[model samples]
Target: MEITFLGTGAATALPLPFCNCPLCCKARTSGGKDIRKRSSMAVNDDLLVDLGPDTASAAYLYGFPLEQVQYCLQTHSHSDHFDPAHLITRLPEYASAGVVPMKVCGSSLTLKHMSEGVFREDEGTDMLSPEGMQKLSIQIHQAFPYSTFSAGRYRITTLPCGHDPGDGSMVYCIQDGNSTLLYATDTTSFSQEIWDFLISYEFHFTAVVMDHTYGSGINGEGHLNQDQFIEQLRIMRKNGIAGEQTLVFATHISHEGNSTHSDMEREHAAHGYAPAYDGLSIRI
Candidate 1:
């Protein structure tokens, strides 16, 4: 499995446009890994996790071919994560040629909101309707927490997340061949139920990309800080969900109390994971 981080910044991204904080200022001046876009990921060349507002830009910047993506696992309807305007571009009206059919998997509520978002952009365009889906060459697969489903060559298990409970936000455990990945972001610490589920499933992850929206000692609602992030890694290790060879990465990074990409790597190296930056790709 090859995992490419299309973007790895929090909702506000690495640098606040109007703020001149030390971190943001440094990011503006030193634009490399420190520069981040909204959070999103691509699995191999076919599957995408979160078709966010920055997805196209990230793909262009990172040299990923967006036309090859056939499946999307949407976490929620958050504007930063799901951009109806972008999705709408696949429509025939845009004159896009040979667009690959896409299957979008998410909670019912999330799909509903996505459909509504499309409608908002183009009046009367309902993603939930068969006619609308056919027009866009897309399919909606409503997923529920704890359910397992197949998308192409991948086996996906949906796990509930602590953020946006109203939207039934979910994280994913994806398995392809000998590799398994746990993609968890835009979330708080895992719940006991989720832990129990992982333990019961006996899932051993090859890679993990989790939320680290806040830096050490900083508290953020509906997202994990550095301390909480480390604690979760410990629990994963204790439960045998992650082994010593497992590749772990922290994503959804924010500028609030968080240092630049290089500094973050040095700071977090001892914890068995490094911060993921835009365009970073790993294969297992």
Candidate 2:
């Protein structure tokens, strides 16, 4: 399986455009890996996670054939996570009929926001002509707490992720045969049940894409502070959630959680993991 890191920054991405915050300033001074887009990933040229604003750039940089994606897995309705406007571009010019109806799986909130705000044309769709607004072959699946489903060769299991409560959010357990990967983002520490699930399932992991949003914040509610995140990693190891070859990655960096990309990598190195930057690719 091939996992492509499209973007790995937090909601606002790395350097928040016009800001002089210490992190942003340092990012400007130290360009390259320090630069981050939004949070998203492309899996095996078929499935994807989140559809952020920078999809075009990410695809271009990684040489992804945008029309080739057959499934899209969403985590929530955050503008940074699921941008329908950008997704709709796949309807016409960007993709022909062969690419129109790819399945989109996510929570009810994630699906509802896209259907009502986008597919239904609830309002403001004048720009997309009838041809551009062709009804897509989108399949919305329920990604509630601990729901599992399958599509073709992959098995998907949604786990609880602490981020939004009213709308809810999820982390994905994606597997193909012996290889399983935990796609965790827009999350803090796992809930007790989720922690138990990780312990109960002794599958060896190809990788763990984690949410490192709070960096060093005090228990920021629904978000993981650095200390707690490290503790959880320790537990994951103790419970056989990872093997000696399992790759642990930290992602979703916030402006407040800012540091030079390398500096951040060094911090996670202490936990035996590495930080994610835009365009990094992982194969498992």
Candidate 3:
């Protein structure tokens, strides 16, 4: 599977407007691969996880066929993770596609709020009907652990993401014929329940792109810092859940992560996993 990290910053973005912190300043001056945006990604050119506010711009900038994407699985209703207002443009009025409408799935809050929030606006979404859902192959399934959804060539199993009240988030154990990938983010630490679920599973994980919103000794509730990521990596390696060949990447970064993305890179390299950046394409 080819996994591409379209954008890797948190909602506010590195160099968040007006915050003259060290991280933001370094991001402003740094010119190479260090430029990052909000978190969102494309898998094997078909499946997508999260539709952050950055999607439209990233789609244009990174050269992914945004409208032609197969499945869009939302993790939660967080505006940073998913901004349906931005996604609604692809529905009917903004971009006219000759093919099927986009498939969107998530928890109830994600789907319902997106529908009420975006499609109902200025009648910009008219072609979207129940038939469009069928046409695009968009099926809303409850994001409970171990429940699998088979759509053509991909087999998607939803796992729990640690965050929020009862609203919920998810991790996808996505598999094709031979390889499997775990798309997990927006989780602070890998919760014990989720850890147990992965331990019970059989496939070798090719890659894992996770939230590294914090860096070093900083702490937070719903997101993982660099130190936390290192801890989790150790756990995975020790438990045989992952190995040397299994690539680990940290993403969903904030400008407050450190002085620069290099700081994050150095720290992550010390732990052995690279920090995921925008437009990074990895094949597994």
Candidate 4:
């Protein structure tokens, strides 16, 4: 499996537009990996996680074949994650040519919120309706927690994210051939139920891209800080879910207490995981 991080920043992205804090100022001075877009990822050029506001721009900048994307797994309907403006462009009225039909999978509430976003953008385009979905060249598949389903050649299992309870946010376990990935973001620590499910399912991951929304010692509700992130990794390792070869990466970063990308990489490298930056790609 080929994984590409289109963007790796948290909800507000790195370097708030109007703020000039130390981290933000340093990010401005140190361009390269410090520059980040909203959180999003692409798998093997075919599947996308989170159609965020910067998805198109990030893909274009990184030379990813965005046109080949056939499936999208939405974690939630947060504006930073699911931008209806991008989805609206698939409508024939936009003169978008040769658009591939997209299959979007998410919790029912998430899907409903996304549809409402589309309605807000296009003025009454109800993406929940069959006619509306056909016009947009998209299919909405409601994914329930703990259920596995197939999308094209990949098998996906939905896992609840203890983030936005109202939106029914979810993480994902995606498998393609012999490679398996755990895409966990916009989440706090896993619940006991989730741990039991993972144990019972005998899931061993090839790679793990997990949430690190806050930096060390920083408290952020509905997100993981460095300490919490490491604890989760410890549990995964103890349970045999993440073996020695598992490529672990921290994503959905923010400028809260987080330092520059290089600094973070150096700090986290000893913890069995590294911070992912925009355009970073790996093969498992």
lDDT of each: 0.93, 0.76, 0.72, 0.93
**Tens digits of per-residue lDDT for model 1, 1-284:** 98999999999997888889999999999999999899999999999999999999999988788888889999998998999999999888989899999999999989988998999998878888999999899988999999999999999999999899988899999999789999998889999999999999899999999999999899989999999999999999999999999999999999987999989999999888999999998897
Candidate 2 residue-wise lDDT at 108: 76
Instruction: Give the local distance difference test score of model 1.
Output: 0.93
lDDT of 2 by residue, 226-273 (tens): 776787788778878886788988878777755788897787888788
Tell me the TM-score of model 4: 0.99
User: How do the predictions measure up, each by TM-score?
Assistant: 0.99, 0.89, 0.89, 0.99
User: Worst 10-residue stretch by lDDT in candidate 2?
Assistant: 124-133
Which residue pairs show collisions in model 1? none
Q: Arrange candidates by lDDT, highest first: which order?
A: 4, 1, 2, 3
Shift of residue 121 alpha carbon in model 4, Å: 0.1
lDDT of 3 at 175: 84
Going through the candidates in the order shown, the clash numbers are 0, 1, 0, 0
Clashes of 1: 0
